[model samples]
Target chain A: MPLLAEGSFNLLSVDPGLVFWTVVTFTLVLLVLWRYAWKPIIEALDARNDKIEGDLKKSEDLRKEAEDLLKSYSDKIDSAKHEVNGMLEKARKDAEDLRNKILQTAQEDATIVKDRSKNDIEQAKVKAIREIQELSVDISLKLLGNVLNQDVNDEEHRKIVLRELEKLKSSN
Target chain B: MLSVMNSLALVFALTLAQAPANNQGQIVPLQKVESGVSAKETSVKEDGAEAASADVHESAESFDLNEVINHHLGDVRLRDFYIMGYNFPITKRVAMMWVAMTLLLVILIPAARSISRNAAKRPGRFTSMIEVFVTFIRQDVGENTMGHHSRSYEPFLLTLFFFILFCNLIGLIPPMGEIAVKAGELFGYQFHLEPGDIPLPLKIWSGITPTGDLSVTATLAITSFFIIQISGLVYQGIAYIKNIVPAGIPWIMWPILWPIEVLGQFTKPFALAIRLLANMTAGHMIILVFLGFIFQFQQLAIIPLSISISVAIYLLEIFVALLQAYIFVFLTALFIAGSQHRH
Candidate 1:
């Protein structure tokens, strides 16, 4: 090695004085700065970070709440629409039932009227036929009694008249 | 090791070669010291004279490579600066330590105030930058390394980082030692400055960086070493010492392993001190050497080359300044963490 200056100029040599001063300076800096600087700054930074995180979490919760509200609203609207459709279906079924009842009542009324008219007509026809048959029998009895001047209530004459009338009715 | 030996040989050869050219016609007055010698003491006295002459010869030269390297690496004495017939004796290392601390105060005091006052608001750019470093050290270095126990040590780690950072950066400012001497020589010739008529740098300070000094770095390492021990004690309590040996090691192997573990403890801090000292010293030495080359060769052709090389090294030194500071703090955290957690 190139020779070094003998006194107070060695690179490896430690000055006790310097060491003492450095320790003092370093210790003082640590103490003063710890109290003044690092503690407050770190606390503030942590607080800010915590605040930011809290805000983010709060926003997330609010978003979830809104989403839930929206879901419920849509569900309400869906159920209302379903209820309206059900009501409309029930109304349509009611109208259809009313129309069927009216048609059934009209058909029954027409059938009952037509049957009564037919029964009335058939009764009138039966009465007219009975009158005609009674008149024919009376005329025949009167003419026979007046012309012959005999007893009209006799059994042989009445039997003959009735038998003739029966033959006539069969031929007609 | 071989390379170091080889480089020493080269330096010796260069010094031997430069001595003759530098000392061509210079003669020392040996008669002044040769008078008071007995016969038995004559040889010893002559040897002393020879040694003194050698020292004179070495000092008389413009610059030697090793001398410049050592000069750059060595501590500055407070004796270099004196005021009004009073000598305030302290090493430049301590003075530079004070400078670094002062710079820290200048930067951090305002930053701390701003951070506190505007706790809710977003920080400004400068405040944000400082916050980034503070948070990084607290969370990344402190928490990541020491976990829950990191809270107690973050301030110390921050101090260490900024202190060494400032020291290294301030050291890289080419020590105005030679320039100041030249300026004083020029002033001596041109005019005289009476008491209190000089600048502070000229009167009160020498251009020295503290982190480059071994004593400062050693103190730091020693402090870190103690902190490591204290942290271990705090976290591990009475069981701290038991952490040194591997848990599953055979009882017989404890004798072998214990010394290694203990040695590891001292070596860690020792390595820390040396790493910082050597890094800061080497960067300064490279810059000094490059600048010294221009003078050593005294050639017009080497001027630009030396300037360019010195500039390059200076840039690298800047990077080294910041990097070495980070490495020192990072390793200190790692060491403290290691001590606490053991495995």
Candidate 2:
């Protein structure tokens, strides 16, 4: 039995001594590595990660500041546009008011000149009618004296003027 | 595709049939072992007879396929190496394991020191590659799988990956057994080797790769098993025992379900150990068997063909080495993760 057992390779069985050695070596190596290598290695990797994260955050902050500056500049531009629009509206209103005042003053002066011309024409017509009437009355008196060969007194002259005025009225 | 597979199946069957015939041809002692038979009479069979070529025929008849295959697959303690009169008996498995461990230390310890000194600087190319492996485990396996326990288990998972990867890759390097034999001779110690004759308990399946042996894989799996249980206990305290039977099962079913779940725990590690051992061992065996084809045929014409086929398998074995290492780490992380969440 021993001779046969010593010549074969049994795949299923375990050697306890080998297993013990394997565990011992594995544990020893693990302990040595954990102390000498793995701890610092993990720390260094974490530190690299932290550095990368910090850089990303700084860039993000700078980007946000630039956006804010851009927004403020746009706000200033918007306010300037509003002020220019207000000044343009006010200038347009003032020009409209000045034009209205000029038109109103021209209309008033035209009315005053038309009224004075109308009064002068009326006065001139009245004075010309009076002169014509006196001339006609004198001519009629001279003609009467020549034809009758008689001197006329004041009362007689007045009565003749009144009679002539009354005859003109009766005729109208 | 079915017909093609059928044809390959036929080809494979033909090779299988051819192997035994070739082996029989070498072992039958056809014209070489007759007592009192003259070399001239053996060589004079109505064909081209050369007395000098009878020795060639005798030499070719001794190649035993089973014995050669067994010697390559089987393990034993080779001759001991004596240094300053202190004899050290070294098996091929142990030597290969030492090589793997030494290689990992050489690469990782320096890279680790570089990072520790100036951590702010970016890693160089080789360091970056190592970082890729480390970060892959940290992020993909550890953090993604174990969550809170990721940081705690990172170093262990890293070590397991490097160890297994080195073992698998080192096994692919040829002539390791021959190298052990030569080392024994160099030390002026000659031990009688009964090749292919060592029995089960005395045999140490050797070439390279301790991972190819159950002793190594079982140890690794057992360690993982302990970690799994301990982490579960630590995280859940005594309540972790409640995880033995899943929630929502009836009280009546507890007896049946409890044993099954407990068995399931053990079976997982068993499978883990077997998967790695079988993969590494099978790859090495296939390469050895392919090379054995040259011996089985004993023809110079078939040597090139056998070598080319073995080279193709060699490339696949290299890919498997990396893949199996990743898989081992991945599964260990998965098991650790599973322990954290009981269900």
Candidate 3:
């Protein structure tokens, strides 16, 4: 049912009866409830809502911390890779240097052995050449003397002895 | 299949038969007309009146000893009462309102005492339900509207919201209707519960719904309007006038924007009054219509349909009870907020 005053612009026209009791009723009830109901109920409700909001804040903070940790691990992983590469490169360079030093030592040792053998051989050859040539002449002479006794021709024996004496002199 | 249709047919037949019964037993001044016809007249009048005045005059003829209550305050003859007199025959609503308040206190006082009786235990259904409602309004409506910015008004708003709720809820109870009408009755037995076979309005020997009374609603709305503006003025002082005219409007546009802005301020509170008055009044009319059927039919056979409609309406009225309360409080807050806040 439409309860409005029709065709009137008396914008504030209202049924006085409804208004008066509403105020009375409202006042009485408000007084009673203000004392008992309003305080505890509102307090409890605000407390409950505050608790829920607090929990939500904690969850958000935890989520942020987890993201930070995840970022740190990722950064650490990159740096670890760099450090390992640097160590690997240093190890490889040291290995190459050690190998070169070892090779140089072996070459120096080989050179020493070669020079000592050549020196020894040279000394031995210089001392032995004269004596060996003289010895060979004396031995040949003895052999020829034995052959002359058996069948020696005087002229060939003299020529052989003279050639042998000349050859020995030139060798000395 | 014929029976199902017949059953529906049976229901209609019963409704038609019962329709005349509610009207039959009803006594009217015009004897020759017979309730058969005169009752129809009352029904039509009641319906039209319902549609027109609705809850506005619901308590008018129902209030008894109304002059005595108003006499204490001095009614129309007294110039102040005449000019700004309280309407809605304040006696019964005031009394009933008292009763309801006492009842809530009675219920809550023992309840409060008992909360500590079971220390550490949460309150039970009634207590807890009251708690939940109080808390919801406190945080959602009260705090949100006023904020900590104005703690002074928080308690006031909270009070307004619940009081409106109690009035609305008490009005919904069928007995309270009779109680209200009974309180105003001059001739009939005060405690008669549905006296005759025909449904009867509480034989109010005289009076009306206080909230339905326009004078009362206007007083409320106007006072609230004053408070909204004055407080805005006090808080903002001379700047409150700014609410009547927008700050950034072009100088040439003052002619257009000024009136509208000014009218908006008054209308905000006007809407609150009408809204509260309307919601409260509308509920009674709905219940009356549903009850009118039983009297119109005169047959008991329509009980099923009547009961069905009544129950459905009652369930809906419960919501209206709370909704009207919230709307009243919200509008008050909105008007208050608008005036206080810039634009």
Give the DockQ (2 decimals) of all models: 0.18, 0.15, 0.12
Q: Rate residue A28 of model 3 by lDDT.
A: 59
The better candidate by DockQ, 2 or 3, is 2
Q: What is the TM-score of each candidate against the true structure?
A: 0.67, 0.65, 0.51
With a 3 Å backbone cut-off (N, CA, C), the pairs that clash in candidate 1 are none
Candidate 1 docking: what grade? incorrect
**Which should have the higher lDDT, number 1 or number 3?**
1
RMSD per candidate (Å) reads 11.0, 10.2, 12.5
Encode model 2's per-residue lDDT on B206-233: one tens digit a residue: 3456787798899899888998888888
Model 2, runs deviating above 4 Å? A1-10, A81-172, B1-58, B65-89, B174-207, B299-301
User: In model 1, where do residues sit more than 4 Å from their true spots?
Assistant: A1-9, A87-172, B1-63, B66-73, B79-88, B174-199, B203-206
Off by over 4 Å in 3: A1-25, A31-81, A107-142, A149-172, B1-151, B170-223, B236-271, B298-315, B341-343
- Looking at candidate 3 chain B, the ten consecutive residues that score lowest on lDDT are B71-80
Using lDDT as the yardstick, the better of models 2 and 3 is: 2
Query: What tens-digit string does per-residue lDDT give for candidate 3 at A1-172?
Result: 0111111222245435535555656565666666665555445555556767887899899999999998999889889988999989989998888888888888888888888888888878866864665466455655666766554335576567668777877899
